[model samples]
Each structure stands twice: as structure tokens, then as C-alpha cells.
Target: MITPTITSLLNAKAFESLVQSRRSVRKFDRSVSVPEEAIHRSLQCALLSPNSSNMQLWHFTWVKSPEVRARMVPLCLGQNAAKTASHLVVFQTRIDLWRRHARWNLEQTPPSSGSESDKRRMQLMRKYYSVLMPLAYRTDPFGLNTLVRKLGSFLLGLTRPVMRLGGRGWQRVLLHKSCGLAAQTFMLAMQAEGYDTCPMEGFDAVRVKKLLGLPAGSEICMIVAVGKGTPAGVYGDRKRLPLEDVVSIV
Candidate 1:
């Protein structure tokens, strides 16, 4: 087993501070520049985020070209965050690569040790990526696959709990959930690197997709603008519902 470092054990307060200090910075200091290494490290940390079934049906596009960045500003509705930021990272979901990813996962299964238990475990892992993944992701122009999944779920759930499956809409939601987790991780990592970010959802999706040349099966989750934030970027003090109102212990 891996050993935990002393830094990890004593970093709880540091982590809390990091979370508290992070803000949705709307304006960036144009004179200040963020290092390329900071963005590289933050993206690396984002890759380690938890995802559904380890399929990793996500992609990050770092817009470093000045030409593209200028074009993206209007696409992002001419937001100040996009206009003044040093970098813009686009988070996207690639549901069309499910088959390739599933096969890759199956290939990663360890070879059996000839023991019955090991053999069975390998068999299950193989089936999970090969058979079950297809069952979850496959779609057709007609609604036949969706109908079959609904019927199967209903019949199986009568006796035991089963996952409710749907068509493309459900698949998109699942991928977006995973992509959102990565985006949060990226933002936190950027904060740790002494930078600021603004996750912007106010964008023309169709035009952005066309500009980025994204495939039809791919969907943008969010675009995060990163830079050295100005003091005025923080609009006001943070506000939220009291813990008693928002939290429940059962």
C-alpha cells in the first residue's frame, strides 16, 4: 500500500483556506501574465478527477492562440472574464468515443493468475467493459434500444434494484456530470497555483462548436477563463443560506 505524506496529514486548514479564497473572478489584470506551467499543472490535476466508469469521455481544449482567443470573446457573449483572461479552457464531453474507451478499459484488465477467484474477477471486468458498457451507451436512430433498456430495467427492478437507463439525453447528462467534476478540480488546482478562474456558461454553443470544429457527438460543458484576477473582480462578500437551512442530518 502507498504511504500518506506528512504534508497531506497537516494540510486540512490549507485546503479549507484554498476553497475559501477561490472566487469567480470576472476581471483580470491584463498586465499580469500566467505561466504556461501553471495551466499545464492544473490540467494534469484535473485528469485525476473521478469520472464515470473510468471511460473518461471528456476533453479539455486550451485556447492559447491569440487569434482564437479574440474570436472566442464574442462567442462567450463578450464577457469581461473572457476578454481579459490569459487563457480559456473549454471542457467538452465526447460520448461518441464510448466504444473505443470501453475497449481500452477491457484491455487494461490484469491477466488471470489461474486461480478460480482471479479468473472470475477478470471475467467480470472484461464483461463490464465489453458487454455492460455497450448496453449502457449504444443508441440507434430508432428508439428500439431505449425501449429495450426501459423494459429490461422495469423487469429486473421488480425483484432487485437496477439502473434506470434512457437514450441520448440520459447519456449526455451522465457525461456532463463527470465533466463538471473535472472542471471543479481544474478550478481548485488553478487557485492553488495562485491564479483565478471564471466558469462561464453564457456562450453561443452552436457558434463555439463550429469555431472549435467539435464533432456532432461532442458537447461543451463549460469554458473557464484563467488569469491574474483584479481586486475589483470580486463583486462583493460571499452570501449563502445558513448551514442549518441548507444541511440535513439523518
Candidate 2:
């Protein structure tokens, strides 16, 4: 039998415990206010999440003001979870940030006078723009799918994979995956901090956009509620498909 590596053991011990312990909390005690420090700490964990090219495309807002929660909870299709939770985190994915990052890559040509490390940095920036240029300037780009997405995928059909590797139309999907990962990282990190979380999907997007003052192209993905757990009016018994039925390893 082969022995497990030390790194693998450490990773399993650190992450697996957190994953197993997390639950989608529905019942939150209405009276208790979540500590601002705890919220900040959980967000700090999210800051450490892996992002594409270190682009860090995710933005978060903690909605705790009574007026905002009152208005926002109705947006969640009347889900009391939003109205009652101690805090609601609004996850916004801005497409312009990726473009900004790409632009930075272009503007920040490494000075020719820095260390060897600086020379490598400039080379990397040039390489980054080389890939993002086609993506940034492509006509009829995005297919209007997402306002923002993966860098290389936007250049697909115009660029050859074996030749330069555009990875086809996987950009939008990849962006969604990256953003989703950030969202989950935030939620699970909250769990790790011993706070209960409820991820909500039912909501009025148009109204939410109006409420948030978002421009024409932005879309709301989901809302996450955090607080202490309770029993009354809480979402009951979550049923999921069995792992045997849901997972298939080839």
C-alpha cells in the first residue's frame, strides 16, 4: 500500500473538517446581532481565496441596516431568511474589474532597470496583455452572456489552441466558477468562524438591481444570510440527492 504524503494529510485535516461541519443554517435567532469582528474575520478568509491571475474579481457588501434588510428581504421572494438574519452579504461580480486588471497589465510595463525579478514581471505583464488584448477588443464579444468572464475564452475561435490556446468559449463558465468559488469560500469561512449561513436564490433580480443601483448589464447571482441559528420559521430539513447517485468517477 502506498503511504499518503505529509502535505495531503495536513490539507485533509485542515480543510476536510471545515467542509464536513458546514451546514446551510435557516433558523436564526432574531435578537442577537452578529459581531462585526467576526464578520470582518470571515471576509478576511475570503480575501485569501484563489482568484484568476490574482484578478480578485469578487466584491462583497454586508447589509445589516434595518431599512436595507427590510427592503432586501422582500427581494428574496419573501424568504424570511433575508429579513431576519443578523446580516446579509451581497455578492457582486463586476466585469469592469477584469478589464481594469487587463488594462493594468498593459499600462504597467516593467521598468527595464529593476532586478531580474522585475524583468520577469514585465515579461509576464506583456504575456498577459497578449492574451487579454483579443479578449478586451473583440467585436460582438461576450454573446451578451456575462458582462465579464474568463480571459482566454473570449479570444476563442479567433485564436488556435495548439498554436496559442484560447480554450474556446469556456471563459464565461470559468468566470462563473471562479466567482462561485469565492462566494462559497466566504460562506464556508463564516461557518469555520462558527457563524450560521443561509444561501438564498429566490429573489427579484430586476428589483435587486434597482435597489443596488447597478447598471444595465449586472446580474444578481445569490444572497447569503449569516447569524445565530434558531428554530421558529426557519427552513426545515434539507434533502439532497445521495452521493452514490450524484457522483460518478470514471
Q: Please, what is the whole-model Cα lDDT of each candidate in the order they appear?
A: 0.94, 0.70
TM-score for each predicted model, relative to the true structure: 0.95, 0.74
Clashes of each: 0, 1
On the 0 to 100 scale, the lDDT of residue 13 in model 1 is 72
Q: How close is candidate 1 to the true structure, as a TM-score?
A: 0.95
lDDT of 1 by residue, 67-97 (tens): 9999999999999999999999999999999
Q: How do the residues 42-72 of candidate 2 rate in per-residue lDDT, one tens digit apiece?
A: 8887778776666655677778677888888
| Predicted structure with the largest TM-score when compared to the true one | 1
Model number with the top lDDT: 1
lDDT of 2: 0.70
Instruction: Give candidate 2's error at residue 169 in angstroms.
Output: 8.2
Runs in model 1 with CA error above 4 Å?
Answer: 1-9
